[model samples]
Target: MIHRLFRHIDAGTTSYTDETGANPVSSYTCADRLDRERRTLFRDTPLLVGFSGRVAKAGDYVVEEIDGRSILITRDREGAVHAFHNVCSHRAAPVAQGSGNARRFVCPYHAWTYGLDGTLQSIPDGRSFDGVCKSAHGLSEIPSAEKHGLIFIRPGGGDPIDVDRHLAGLERDMAAYGFDRFHHYRSLTIERQMNWKLCPETFMEGYHLQYLHRESVGPIFFSNLMAFDSFGPHTRLTLPRRRIMELRDRPEEDWRLIPETAIIYNFFPNVTMVVQAGHVEMWRSYPSGDATDRCKVQVSVFTPEAVETEKARKYYEKNIDLAIRTVDGEDFPLSEAIQSGHAARAHETLIYGRNEPALTHFHASLNGALGA
Candidate 1:
């Protein structure tokens, strides 16, 4: 991949699709389209919820509400991962809140307790009803699995997650990163006034780096150049940094791709995994509510190893801060304007240039899924 990227830089060419693609503006601005996507893409599919390191120990759990559906992910005593709907069997109250280690999740609404495995442990007052079966009332399980250091859940719940099938052939590349051992650094959730799809689109292509991010992160990377490939509905982009040119002088045996450039894996629908030089970043975007014009994005950073010292924590903190500033301050402002333009009816369709093949593939896959 690095060699291909170097050749692109040397020839002033970039990876491109056969031709330009056009997508209807309604794909972003229509509520009906958003609803269909939430059903097919977000609920039925195995969405990337988080990393394995977040729930590294027994009783550790995290609660995340994606696209308005609350999900609970837990690690049991036997070192197994599980996911649930987070709603209590009694009166539908959320059994888990935020994140922490707890042997039991007790619903604040009525004290209905659940085990780490999501089994209903006990009722506040047993025998209130004639014959309510505790075994049948456990938290509704959401199809989940842990793979390649990542946690995925199908919110609507169905068959068990087949990690290899879900990832297609991208598992081999993801396994190389050793993400299971990567330590969580920090995360920020920011509300954006834009469609959910538009959020990840910003990271899909390098075409805008030299112009949009010229003063921020542009100069560090080669403009409009990347190594792109697709695995099923997913896409992988290897964006070469300007410094990658120096690799031509070094021996091929010494070439290291991970540290030399940014590798982005855009999982179908809504997850983006970016492998940076020293750390990894995961971005998850979801619709804010029923609205097509609003969405929320969570950006989390991870270090190669756990931070044991204050200095190490501060170092990663600064890294995440820079990332937040570059996206929140620079990229988002324009995305918001683009969203506003859609509302203004300036154009009925948005064109994806051949150079932006990742965006083309993303929208095409999204539309295909929605239609299916």
Candidate 2:
């Protein structure tokens, strides 16, 4: 009966149904999906990038990659957050290296300079070019907005949708976890040899925990899972507690012991947030090319008393390290191998088990986006 339920959810929409009366998995194998994601979704659409805590100061900045486009995120003199294409207007050279405090960005290729506001301030020998206009030659501006302590950038050149409206239900979820008060401690990236979709899908369900993470994490979490409603293209999953004595026998009214022990939020296309009892970790997956996907998983450990004590800081860091190493060393390698297997057979369709509702939702959403 559970297997039948899995088939029903995995079957997806009419557009993805196979002629053989079987459910068809959307083809993420095509270069078209990758290309579209790069051009339309990453470049053109507004994508959630990082938290605001890292660049709270006016001069602070961070260098990030979006859909293969290098981006420079910074705050202006007035403290407004801005994003610009990392490439300089002159000779297309990269204006900045890895992130740090920068009053202005200078193009190394030809000594062109641009202010944090993206204004082209100087060019070597301004009089040499009679018709050259600095205003028209400014660095390309990418739309960026901050909300719920998160930074979002739109690479496609146009007005962006309000971040608040786009985040709708997610805002409440974050609020419930006191995300606004959460502080960023550190971030780490894990490069995996798998389709970008695989990372989030692997994390969306707890069914694999019993087998894959048995020795490490399985003891702390329940295998049977419940999913919260979908928020637009995003879905959230709630993992019940397993052996933790503090949570085991509590009534539903006493859920505050952990306040939903674990919450997994998938933010469409390729971003996911895992909110644990003590910290919130985020994963942003980007396709490296047609065949490989590189994912950046950031673990942000938050506690009101974190900055107050050195031991608290060390404890959080150690926990984060353990989590990152376990996922990187164990889960991702398996996911990469699976992705290779999937691409090896063009006609084969993958199946999602009953408890894997998040994966089912993901495939269905992808089909809708691709109009497949």
Candidate 3:
């Protein structure tokens, strides 16, 4: 992948697709389309929910809401990962709130308790309800699996999650990163006034880097250049920094990609894994409350090692600040304008140029999943 990026830099060319692609404006404006997308792309698919480090110990768990589906993920005492609906088995209220280490989850609504494995452990006044069977009232289990140091959960239950099968051949490239060893640094949730699809699209193409992000991150990278490849519906994009040109004077065997490029892995519909110079940023976007024009994105930053000192925390926090300034401050505001434009019906469709192969592949994959 580094070699491919070097070649693209030398030739002043980028990866390209066979042709251009078009996505209807309605894809981001219609409620009907959003509903279908939530079902097919989110519910059925095993999404990258969190990393292994976030739940490294027994009883560690995380709660995340994806497309309005409250999900609870936990690690049992026996070192097993489990996922279930956050809802209580009693009156359908959430059993847990945020991430923590807990042997049991007690519902805030009625104090119905559940074990880490999602079994109904105990209920307050168990004899009060007649004809109620505790054995059949365990928390609703959802398909979940952890692989390659990444945790995944399928919001709508069906078959068990197969991480290797879902990743296809991409894991061969990801194995070197040792994602399982990464330490969680920070996490945040931000709601943006744009379609959920627009959040990931900003990272897919470099066409606007030199222009939109000119003052912030543009000068550090070449404009409109990317090394792109697709594995099934997922994609790996390599964006070389301007410092990458320094590799020409170094030996081929010493050409390291970690410090000279930004690698972005798109996990199909809603998740993006961005590997930066020293840290990794994971983004998961979802439609906000059934509105096509509104979206919420969950962002988490992971470090190669645990941040044990104040200096280390500050260093990683600086990276997060730059990301917020570039994406949240610049790209997102423009995306909001784009969403407003789509709502106004200014154009019937949006065009993806041949040079933007990743964008084309993503939207095409989304359409295929929606059966459109």
> Of the pair 2 and 3, which is ahead by lDDT?
3
> Which 10-residue window of candidate 1 scores lowest in summed lDDT?
315-324
Give the Å error, residue 85, model 3. Answer: 0.7
Best-fitting candidate, measured by lDDT? 3
Query: lDDT per residue, candidate 2, 75-179, as tens digits?
Result: 889988998889888678899877778889888888899998889999888888678899998888878988777778887878865886777577786656555
Per-model lDDT: 0.87, 0.69, 0.88
Better of 1 and 2 by TM-score: 1
**Per-residue lDDT of model 1, residues 282-332, tens digit only:** 889999888998998988788888888999878877767777788899988
Cand. 2 TM to true fold: 0.85
lDDT of 3 by residue, 261-361 (tens): 88888998888888997799998899998888999999999899999999988888888799877888998899999999999998998999888999999
Error of 2 at 330 (Å): 1.5
RMSD of each: 1.2, 5.6, 1.3
Q: Which stretches of candidate 1 lie over 4 Å from their true place?
A: none
Ranking by TM-score: 1, 3, 2
Prediction 3 global C-alpha lDDT = 0.88
Worst lDDT run of 10 residues, candidate 2, spans 13-22
TM-score of each: 0.97, 0.85, 0.97
